[model samples]
Target: MSHVYQELNPGPFERKASMMITTNLSVLINDVLKGAATLLNQNWAITAAVNVFIIFFTVFLYLNTSTTSDQVTIRSASNNAFSGGNTTTLKEIVFHPNYGGLWKDDLALIKLATPANFSEGVKSISIAKSLPKQGTNAVVVGWGPKSYFSTTDGILREAVVPVMNYETCKQKYYPIFLFTDTSFCTAKDNVGPCPHDFGDPLVYKNKVIGIFSGSFDCGSTTYPAVYADVTQYNKWINKVIKS
Candidate 1:
């Protein structure tokens, strides 16, 4: 069976829409999985880094050829002011070997040059050990632009979205794009991450479960937002942090 899949780009900061028609589901699935295995085993050298305390944020932050480790900086605890928080430079970036073009396993760890001093506002978050169940309420946070027409105001924002059924989500993007086990979807509530919010964390019960990957219309009521399943990479994360 062949399916036609189409995605729309909200603006310059969002992914461009592409039309795809596929008949071989098994082959596509196999290729994506294999590609992840090969890519995850390799590491790219980018001088950019962020604080380990920030979790997998750098994974989504925009990076270009000119970006360097010392050039990357992270701030924590400031809710309204982007400049009003504890700041630190990044020392190293350890990306998930499995991260690939489809955004599966889209996560990374950063080593801060200095330890972050925890305070009433700045703190660390726990990674989810288990996958979140469908219908569970979760929070997604970011400082990105709220809409395509608006620019980022440097204020941190958050929204509550319910977890969508994995199988149902699979059907929604089937043939055009196959989501692996390392990915999940959240309900579209008209208010979620927009462009420049790729690396934001999806929080469930105070634990990080998902990393914002991508969405067609930001938070389209018709298309649910996709996320990288953080729980699926717990072992890899532990190994890298320990090593």
Candidate 2:
């Protein structure tokens, strides 16, 4: 939906794709009931406390795990950006730990670079091969909650959106892409990133290059904020991938 007169919204960065580990709510509840034993002191208060603890723990574990799907950075373009780097797959995303609804993978080897600005909105990138290998910075082609969830009471969900050069996106997407030095852009060709494909990758160079972070479909393309780009930090990728 690239257009003029309307603000731009160059979604977020791109990268290799990865699957996150999900949780089983039913199994979690069952675990609590199954472990409600052994501590049979007859003390009603103690018994109740024990059960409560188990339930809390199980729910916490289950909830935390739902967002474990690995999100590998994917390469979109096949130009000279990166012609001879590692070709990652969907299975490899699990190697990283999924916690707090954040893809905190290899801080060094893999990373979600600080956000950057493009034009109307912001941008972000996720790193696949750390600095030196590809570069120093990476992308975070993110999706879902623009901000982190304040309450961890439910399952973690992801979002899917588009990305474009901040300035370019602003011209065609929305004005939201114009934020600060910490944002960029991305989205689908017709409808931008949706809620289902949140945190998907936007492949770039030999390794994952950018991230699909944020977006706001406010009927009009004015306020759009997405993940930043990290190609600028390719130096970071080269330094960390080998070590």
Best candidate (score: lDDT): 1
TM-score to native of every candidate shown: 0.69, 0.31
Let me know the TM-score candidate 2 reaches against the reference structure. Answer: 0.31
Clashing pairs in 1: 40-97, 40-98, 47-69, 48-69
- lDDT, candidate 2, 107-160, per-residue tens: 112211211112212122334342222222222222222223211111222233
Model 1 Cα lDDT, one tens digit per residue, 86-186 = 44554566766655545555666655556555433344555778876788888766555657456655444556778876676777776657457667888
Worst ten in a row by lDDT for model 1: 19-28
Q: lDDT for model 2, please.
A: 0.27
lDDT of 1: 0.50
- Global lDDT of each candidate: 0.50, 0.27
Clashes of each: 4, 134
Error of 2 at 41 (Å): 53
lDDT of 1 at 105: 59
